[model samples]
Target: MFEQGDWGSAADWAVAPVDHSRLKHPVQALTAMVLVARQENAAAAQKVFTAVCAYRMGIAEDFDRLGEQAADWLGVGAEMEVALVLGVSVGTARKLISVGVTLDTRLPLVKAAFVAGELDFSRVRTIVDAVDGVSEATVSAVEAAIVDAALQRPPRALANEIARLLIAANPDDAAESRKKREKHSRTVKITPDSHGMAALFATMTAAEGVVVSTRIDEMAATVCRRDPRTPATLRTDAFVALINCETHLACRCETADCPFAHLPAAEPATVHLHVHVDVETLLGFADNPANLEGHGPIDPDLARRFAQDATWQAIVEETRSRCPAKAHPAGFVPTATKLLPPPVPSGIGGAIADIKAAIDADPKVLDGEFPDGHGGLDEPPPGALSYRPRKEVKDKVYAKYSTCTFPNCYVPVRKCQFDHIEPFDHSDPERGGWTIESNGHPACPYHHQAKTDGIFRVVRMAGDAIVWVSRNGAVGITIPEELGGSHEPEARKPVKLTRPAPAEDPPDDAIYDPTWWEQHMQSGDRPPTLADMAQLTDRRLAVIYRELGTHYEEHLAILAARDRHMPPPY
Candidate 1:
């Protein structure tokens, strides 16, 4: 048995040692370790809450002399400071501060239990959130009722218990709160996941949710029996199709007799999808990964699938000539080269350039916007001399970056605001920043305000990398995704296996037959099973076998099925 000492502070308990040797069995040892870890985590959470409370108190005292407006700004600054130190978003830091304050001021007994390692943070958070917006007396009553169950039950069960207690104490208040949340907090969000996947979250009435789910299942079942997709996959596809306003989810079976083959092709959706892929991968010559804007890297096959319904656009890299001008033939004056726009690269670049050249040649394409060759790629367009960059510059900047340049921020460039790297001077344009690609980057609104407010400083290093330095001397570096450059998958090399030669044959009278053992071991095949060695006198060979006979038989069956043009066994 172990005894917990009465430590003066949470830190003392957090660092207390646990003796694992006291437990004789492995299961007992592991269980004891987990118990000790939980206690340590509870103590650590108590310490964190204590620190938050102390910091807020210090901030309030320091800003007491300042006016209300100044104090409000300092409060926001305090949250930002905490966010930077904790490496969390400012929203999360604000929530932590709120939770910490509530725990310290209202739930004294709960806080005491948390400090003593009797409850974890999840249950504490549940109780704190449940008591919010209720009367002080109601809070006290509910906390007293649920505190014991909260310590004994898991977080989910404890949440249910707290909800019941809250409703019992103040049914009208709870009902009003529920009504307000349902009416105001309904939302739809898409969270990006690893490998270019995303999870969709929607908050709506239970009735509406059930209807949508049933509709998806019905739509999924409409596919023919020959359809290769699983029911879950079919449901997902049907849902996506429904959202895109397609009339039906077509069967994926390639047979000519598919029942849904005669259905008319669905019209393209209005939604725009941005994909960045290399020319080689797009042409199926390589397998480099492609980046779907707002998401991370995706397989080339998926990118090609997206391209099936996409409108193609070429992104050409600009190149400058190094050679000097050549002399024209005698009496044959050449046209001025600079007067004409720079030549586009050849091959696919030239093909796309030809379209642009034809459009430039047409007077209608340049109609009101660029009356005098103002919309060319190399120079700023006319009537755009203001602080805002021209469309060409914005396009180039967006192409250069996939997301906001702020460190660790993943807001898509399409949704971010174009920020001038150097502050533009309205009084003297020539002395300040110019609206060009080199001096422009995208930044989310939050970090943009932080930078403008002097809470952070940003510098553009060589190769278009961004360096962020906080007021407290914290530094972070952000590298550009570079459209197709940074995300390209490196070529994988083939792996070679090196196996050492088998040792000399075992001596006679050994349990196993030396010849039979050497043949299987040296050929990288599995050893004989115990039944196979039954005829022999030795039982030691049983340890060497891995029961690979079933796997080998399955492999042979699969190959035979392939030879007969039959589907492989599951």
Candidate 2:
């Protein structure tokens, strides 16, 4: 494709090929990816933007040749030519050029995202539009807030988030936005239809429209019961009656005071879902952003106010168990069970404490948090376990990885499947892997399906890390988010093994002994120390050589018997 296309310059397609090995250090590798991705797209797009800019410059240069009289037209024809090609207004064309110049000179973060291939020209332009009102100083903070999100989220969502952050940073911006909207709002237009009916339309904010709609619906419901109008007719009449402060002429019947005529304002509903924020942000000590469901990054001060006035509930973590999510409990603060809860008193003091202890003591209660420096986290009990993990296990894996385990994939773990590293077999307990946290991890649905269908083989390594090897010998390693957590699931440094050379001697025709090996390996005792394996290599080699010799002798005997018996049997 590169050879076939007229990309203008071979240097344009001189980008480096993708190397997933670099992805081991995702942050750094992402830069190399940006260079290649940018060049690749630029080559494919024929470097049109640059060519257009050059063409515009050429037009300006032509005007300059006309001498002092053509000075006024120096940039005019260029912009007109750009506007014609881009199919945008001349003012818009100018703004695009200005933004391009600004991106080249300022907005380092935006420029970085652009180079990273996270922000294409369209996404970059969307961001520029979103930060249209931000000052120079705040641009960095705004860019930092949205760059990662813009990489992952849709342009509209990213724009909405940046908008909310802008509003939070300076409430004045919200007023300005409101003014802009109001300037373009409430311009109703009526046009007669072919059937002699007419339609009225007006533009308004989303909330305004929703409130007006809900109020009209409420009034229409009441009007429908008292009047014989259809639901549609009632809704129309209700809307008309609301603004007129009188019954609509179209209504065939009316009750005293006419409910639609005196419609009440829409009442807002309170939702109690989780909103993640750090301690500093929550206490108003920092300007770090807070995420809301529909509206992203509202002011921390506003959030604090909401938390203070709005009744909130938290799930209590017991001294040894996770408590059920109920409203505020006596002598206990509300902490969402989804988050890491603070340690509680280890001993029982009162009836409540006793209940908490009992609940905590329940064997069914799962413990799946990442192990700290201490090696005291709950391990799987000695027995065959179920094939499915508890919710706690899934959540722990998701939180630990934070993102999908697939190579070069950044899908959030919460949106992925919790897959078992080793396939569990309920019917064959000894060979089948257990339903334990150590065996399970989060994979995005696509990657999980790929692994399940044998597109890639996922092998669990020491320390709970996983390695994926494709059919064609491609390998990808996914280590823990951080080193030394939960089984220290980090790749260990390479080690050199020194032992007696295999060429020195081969195993003799000795008989095998399994008793000692069984006691050492399959023993239900403490874990074997490093010294055990290192010191036992001689005996292990003897066992392996013995098996190899015995197999050869058996094969020779079978072949000799077959050779002698073949002629007599024929």
Candidate 3:
């Protein structure tokens, strides 16, 4: 029975009243907030769906009056209007309209549940999508079967349940639909991300994906344990190596004793990865960022590494003004100088010329196209090594510890050195301390040195946890990884750490304190108005807007019905 104005102020609609002091745990507070937020979000979405339905109904009236010719134009205009208001793409708006219509027309129960906050948007979208091409008779049954589970399950689980029920309802149609999707929907796409990285997305049959993943894992595992790359990173490198037709990942340990170190480098792939860098940065004179093809700007250091094996090409920028010449009476040369390719361009001047050539090429080259055959674009340079640990010992240590053993340190175990807890008897092997799994712990170089220099002390404790005592007497504890147990003797009377008390909750005024907003405005920023705040709170203004749209749609329908009944003027 809420009226248009009953929703109150934008702040009232947006902020939920949660007594944080009443919640015993942070998790309880968070859970309460999430539930309230979901309810508000659902309410907002229901308003949007209501508005969209009404808008489309009014448009339908125009379509009927103006005939079928105006359908496309009206539809495009409608999508654009929604897109502008939502600040989303036309395609997204179209999808939203379609989902809204589906929810309004077919799945009334789902819509009710959605507005009541029992089902989230993703679950509703999943149900709507699953029933898209389904026969009307079967879809209702599918909706009824899954709506209860959809309330409790995640979107993915809900999708699976929906799929299972769909197949059960009509197995033949489901099989045919899946077959059509597999034939037409398989695609490989690369999307650019921030920080000079790109995500490669591929939609293929599950079997094909499994095959690719297994092959990558196999190739990644071929490297010795001393390789510094994490399993995930190694897998990625292995996938790239497979694309380049290489057998295995090159061990990055870089030690002369490494099994893969002495192996000859694999021949470069025909596909070249182009990098655009400035002349100064290429020559190591500057540290400016360089753009990798497809990917965005990468560190200059990474660019230099790419340059080591890259083929050189020079492209000099030309000026409109002609150079001076002794042959001409005008004392200038009309033709520009044609510079030849430098020999041994791997050196300083040659490297600079190479970079200039790369920069001058078509910007489309960034899309990973280079007709010229060049190799080693994807291969990373070998890292310098200090010491090497036994492969078995390193493997055991890595399996036991996923990250560095130093307190509060999260450096991946692959990137850490296996340090001997009790200094190894290098001079005499049988003199007690040995390079065994019981005595080894992974530590990053910095902390490894500190431990070796007595700046920090770590001792094995009861329950396979390591106690770290710092120089300042601040103590920290590290529990062993889940995969393995330690055989080392435990220390006596280990200190028991106490959990710190939670901080006092902030005063209610802090939620929408005007002091911070005033300060922001004082700093020459544009202060947001109520309308803007309402939009920021996910269309809280829709409370009033939905009411207006409903009345507008009703008026349009009445006009349409009256006009249809009226005699045409001849």
TM-score of candidate 3 relative to the true fold: 0.46
lDDT of 1 at 341: 33
Clashing pairs in 1: none
Which structure among the candidates has the greatest lDDT?
1
Q: Candidate 2 overall Cα lDDT vs. reference?
A: 0.51
lDDT value, residue 332 of candidate 1: 29
The 10-residue segment with the lowest total lDDT in model 1: 485-494
Residue pairs clashing, model 3 = none
Alpha-carbon TM-score of each model against the true structure = 0.63, 0.28, 0.46
What global local distance difference test value does model 1 have?
0.60
Q: In the order shown, what is each candidate's alpha-carbon RMSD? A: 24.7, 27.2, 35.7
Per-residue lDDT tens digits of candidate 1, residues 179-270? 77678767897767876689899988667889999988887876788999988789899999889877787888989988988887777677
Off by over 4 Å in 1: 1-24, 43-66, 70-74, 221-228, 246-248, 251-270, 317-385, 482-570
lDDT of 3: 0.57
Clash totals in order = 0, 0, 0
Q: Could you tell which candidate, 1 or 2, scores higher by lDDT?
A: 1
Better of 1 and 2 by TM-score: 1
**Model 1 Cα RMSD, Å?**
24.7
lDDT string for model 3 (1-570, tens) is 112456666676555577777999888988998888687758766756865864576477547655676554454445534554454544566778888888888988888887777777778888887777677767787777779879788888888888899899998777777787788878997655676677889989879999999998898987899999888899899989998889877688878888777666777786554555655456444566665644445787787676666653333322112242112111112332333433331222332233224323532221121111111122211210213456765665555444676544546666788776656555554342445444567888866765675545655433334544443333444554331122222212222223223335432332232332233224444423222222322333433333333333333334433444444461
Identify the leading candidate in terms of TM-score.
1
